[model samples]
Target: MKIGIGSTNLAKIEAVQRVFSENDEIISVRVPSGVSDQPFSDEETIEGAIQRAKKALETTNADLGIGLEGGVTETPYGLMLCNWGALYSKTDHSPIIAGGARILLPDEISERLRTGEELGPIMDDYCMRENIRHHEGAIGIFTNGLITRGEMFSHVVRMLKGQFIYRMNG
Candidate 1:
């Protein structure tokens, strides 16, 4: 099967690759999120993922398309970093969506995000690293590398793949 992934981010590409067989082709394409660079709500993030999946599928002519998006959401405790993944099939109009690990950001980071700063840059400054999102990400930094961004997204992809398998079998 050919799977077209919406984003060319290495982490997302690697994550999606983990769930599929070696024989299956995984194509990575750079696509827009169709939302703000930093999605502020769960609904917006999910919408972005779905839109990306549709675009990727349409562009690649693949059997399936996958989209992964990361954003921040305001919670009662504080602001949380969230990631979502979506899968789309041409035959099935309904998409299968799943979410990755969510982590509460430090007030310092949250404050900057509230000021309209994107998380990638804020995390780079806070962690004193470059492009942390493309690497371990906030979850990895907070968890001491126990849970990486790729791993988190991979889990969500696995869940979406499960849904696809069930649909195919039933």
Candidate 2:
């Protein structure tokens, strides 16, 4: 089966690669999330993932398209890190959706995000590393490397794959 994944971000692509079979050909195509560069809410973030999956499916004409999106949302506990994933297929009008773990952000990082600065650059400067988003990502940094961004998204993709399989069978 041919799979197309939206976005060229290594972390997102890696997640899809980890969940799908080696027999399935996975390719990355750059596509817009159709939302804010930094999604500030769960609704927006999920919408972005869905858009990416739909666009990738159409763009590549692949049997399946995957989208993984990371963002932050405010909560009573604190602003938290959130990631969402979507699996879109030709036979289904609605895509399979799933979400990964959420970790509370430090007040310092949350402060920066509230000011309208994106998390990618904020994390880069906080860690003094460039392109952290494509690497370990905010989840990795916040979790002290215990939970990687790839692993988090991988779990989400696995859920998407399972649901899609069930959807087809049932």
Candidate 3:
């Protein structure tokens, strides 16, 4: 099968690639730009995914098109990030995965986040940390590399992948 992903995020692309690569039955995987980066409600997220997937399908004419949305939410314990993936195809079927990770933020930083600034940029601004993408994220700065955006996101992606399989088979 040929899969077209509606995202160019390296981590997300890699995670989806890993799944298809292992399957071997999948012939190809492609990542293309999708909807803009902005806050989206759960329903809007799914709708956006569907729209992106449909557009990708029309543009690439691939066997399958995947749209993924990455976002953060507030939980009782802390903040959680999730990657939601919607799979669309004219041939086989459709699937959706709402999986992610969680991390607690410092009250101060959480205030900043509430105002719409991300933890990464805030860390960069205050800590004078340059290009923290490879080194650390907002949470990683105070935790001394305890967790990273990439690490947490990778776990979320893996969880999404597992859900994909279950959806496809079940």
Candidate 4:
């Protein structure tokens, strides 16, 4: 099977690769999220993922399209990290959406986000590291390397695959 990943980000691409078979052809394309650079709510995040999946499918001849989007949302406690993934196939009219792990950001980081700063740059400054999103990401920093962004998205991909399998079998 051929799979097209919406984003060219290494973490997103790696997550999709981990879920698929070695023989499957996986390609990553730089697709638009169709939302703000920093999505501020679950609805927006999920919408962005679905949009990317659809655009990827439209652009590629792959049998399946995958999209991963990470954003932040405000809650009673604080601003929290939200990650969403979507899978689309030409044969299926609807897409399968799944959510990855969510975690509250540190108050310091949340404060910065509230000022209209994007998480990627904020994290880079806070962690004193360059392009942390391509590596461990904020999840890894919060979890002390226990869980990275790639791992979180991988779980979402696995869930999407499970849904597809069930739909086919049942």
Q: Each candidate's lDDT (Cα)?
A: 0.92, 0.92, 0.56, 0.92
Tens-place lDDT per residue, model 4, 129-150, is 9988988999999999999999
Q: What is the lDDT of candidate 4?
A: 0.92
TM-score of each: 0.97, 0.98, 0.62, 0.98
What range of 10 consecutive residues in model 4 has the weakest lDDT sum?
Answer: 53-62
The collision pairs in model 1 are none
Clashes per candidate, residues 3 or more apart or on different chains: 0, 0, 0, 0
The C-alpha RMSD in Å for every predicted model, in order, reads 0.8, 0.7, 4.5, 0.7
Q: Which stretches of candidate 2 lie over 4 Å from their true place?
A: none
Predicted structure 1: lDDT: 0.92
**Decoy 4 TM-score against native:** 0.98
lDDT of 2 by residue, 1-170 (tens): 99999989998899989988899999899999999999999998999999999989999999998888899999999999999989899889888999989999999999999999999999999999899999889989888898888899999999999999899899
Q: TM-score-based ranking, best first? A: 2, 4, 1, 3
Which of the two candidates, 3 or 4, achieves a greater TM-score against the reference? Answer: 4
By summed lDDT, the worst window of 10 consecutive residues in model 3 runs over: 24-33
Model 1 CA lDDT for position 144: 94
Per-residue lDDT of candidate 1, residues 20-86 (tens digit): 9999999999888899999999999999999889888988999999999999999999999998989
3 against 4, candidate with superior lDDT: 4
Over 4 Å off, model 1? none
Per-residue lDDT of model 3, residues 1-170, tens digit only: 66666655455455556556654333223443344343333454556556656655556667666665554557676654434556666655555445444456567766776787755566678787675634555445656778654555456446555666676688
